[model samples]
Target: MILAVLLIAVQVAAQDPRLDRLDPDTRAQVTAVVDSARLAGLPAEPLIQRALEGATKGAPGPRIVTAVRRLSVDLGTARAALGDGASVPELEAGVAALRAGATPQVLANLHSVRRPPLTMALSVLADLVASGVPADSAAVAVLALAPKARDADLVEFRRAVERDIALGAPPAAATSIRVNAGADVLNAAGPPPPGPALPRRP
Candidate 1:
């Protein structure tokens, strides 16, 4: 019975289509990392997906392994920053934000103010950094807008910053100007009225 069960487990494990795309040694390494991630209560899907992405790009086994391992570490760091209650998408975005140089303290501060679906805000921060905005400046800009900016506001803000940069404004200067403009608009609107109480998550 034990041998049969082991055989069934092996068959099931072999069914992941991604595994077939890797050489035996690479497959073994990735599987081990994925299993370790699972045991750590981390989502393994991103790591798996990253491995598949590497394979699709024809990366070597060692390269794929390195990518997966790095993503695993990033995801773990994201989880630590955002806490266990964070959703998978939130964690993913957090990883991107971290990679773009958003500090852990910045993430924690954002978590304190924003509700779920922080993906958009985090992505915008990453975009700003990628577009040459200094990481600290980008974090400040995003955090300033995050308290009151809706999803549309975030999109518009990103476009404005990008446009300014394209127009030859220095990234830090452009971001600072836009962030200040946003703050002015908020201040002009007066204090926000109290809404329904959002229960704090422990």
Candidate 2:
């Protein structure tokens, strides 16, 4: 019994070292939130990381708590969109995509393509939207290129679009040009190559 108790204590302490920095009440609140997320089978690590990020940035206790709670909700939404089998990284990317106006249907469709490591594609989609591209246009553009483009290709595409946008091109036009360019490359190569490595998540 004593050994079991010590093991439990160690487990709890290992959950979040940053929790030690929080005041007692705030720590308790955050711990409760983390426990609830774990119980729900959601990835609680992101929430813990978010809280730690906030704390490191010198945010107040309430704000840190709020950020963690919000991330939990986002993770839940992402899981619902991506289905039960979604990895934590997939869910994280999905949340960012959702926040940038990608509908759950869009997310589902993206996942249906059977591509792994969609983190960069989803992030590029979000970045496009955040850069003033219409969400629908961004989705269309991303979906068209993602199935064929490698991670390096996606990075180049994003950079091209950004450059075009900086040069006074409309977001839609810039995205279209880059996506079409990718298509051109694919057509020139003939037959798709093997899939690229999984995306690296932030």
Candidate 3:
């Protein structure tokens, strides 16, 4: 009986319930803040610690609450935008942009281009997909913006588009682009012909 009691004591001690000490409304706010930090790719433990410290240091509850509330709202927006498939960096970027007040249209436009050397494209696409954009729309938009894209960008974009379509970018969108997208983009963006194929080999 003593051993069981000791074990129960240890388990109870292990559970840190600092937030539970706060009023219900304040606890909700604190949760929102911490969750927001997580969504924004920020470390929540530190933020929560900081808030706790501030509270200890005589900071007004309202101020700490407000700060946490703001952070929470920003995180909520970002997480909503990102859906369920975003990576850390993508979440960070999307959250930052959302915090900075970027619109969905702007995000859509930005998603279409693969940055130089093509290295940035895959990550960008992965993030966009996570953030609730349709795979077909995202792929098509990215390809459309490939004229100014780098070679690496094209390679990665092709890979991502294929992956998305295979996983399902919608039959209609997939068909529209697969049949003609690559050819058209290549024709437009590819280097000029070698002087009409050297006059058809005489």
Candidate 4:
């Protein structure tokens, strides 16, 4: 019976070759979490990776299992907010946003208001919160731009807000101004033009 149990555990956790590095005991526990995630249709790779990361850091087996379980729960929460059709990247971004203090309702709201492939927008929202902007204000800025802004536009807007914050503007104030002014941080001449046009070639 014990041999049968060990074989099943190995089979369940063997999805990733790298997981072979974990001790047998840790592998079995982490495998349970990864299995539950896969059964729920959630991406299992991230959970596996998290366990491997903890192992790499030389954490105890219990610690590694706890971390993997927490990530699995987070993944489930993210999927609930992003909906069934959300891609793996979107759910991953939602997890990051949640960890950064953005609420699940904020994610659900973004899902309703924004279009598909929310990976970049969620990333930006999480980055903004990490940069000290209040989560609600950051959500407002992202929601304001989500209707029409492209992914590249969101990146530029984030940079501009960070710049303003670095220059002493309050985080929320900078976010509001950027959203109202639009995400064209590289406006006028666009990214290609440095200052004036300079003379073009010889």
TM-score of each: 0.88, 0.82, 0.35, 0.82
Q: How does residue 102 of candidate 1 score in lDDT?
A: 92
Poorest 10 consecutive residues of model 4 by lDDT? 193-202
Worst 10-residue lDDT window, candidate 1? 6-15
Each model's lDDT: 0.85, 0.80, 0.52, 0.84
Ranking according to lDDT, highest score first: 1, 4, 2, 3
Model 4 lDDT per residue over 112-163, tens place: 8766789999999999999999999998889878866778989999999999
* Pairs of residues clashing in candidate 4: none
Weakest lDDT window of 10 consecutive positions for candidate 3: 193-202
lDDT of 2 by residue, 1-202 (tens): 9768655644664467778888777777888888777757688789778878887899999998998888888888878767777888788888999999998888877777647667788888888888888899889988888767777888888888988999999999989888998888966877666656765321
Clashing residue pairs in all predictions, respectively, total 0, 0, 3, 0
Per-residue CA lDDT of model 1 for 1-202, tens digit only, reads 9768655544544467768789999999998787767656688789889989999999999999999999889888888877777778888999999999998989988888776668899989999999999999999999998887776788888899999999999999999999999878877887567777765533
Say which prediction, candidate 2 or candidate 3, comes out ahead on TM-score: 2
Global local distance difference test of model 4: 0.84
Per-residue C-alpha lDDT of model 3 across residues 78-192, encoded as one tens digit per residue: 4454444444455455555544335544444444332222224434444445444555555455555544655454455456556666786764365346436655666677753
Q: Which is superior by lDDT, 1 or 3?
A: 1
**Clash pairs detected, candidate 3:** 82-130, 82-131, 118-153
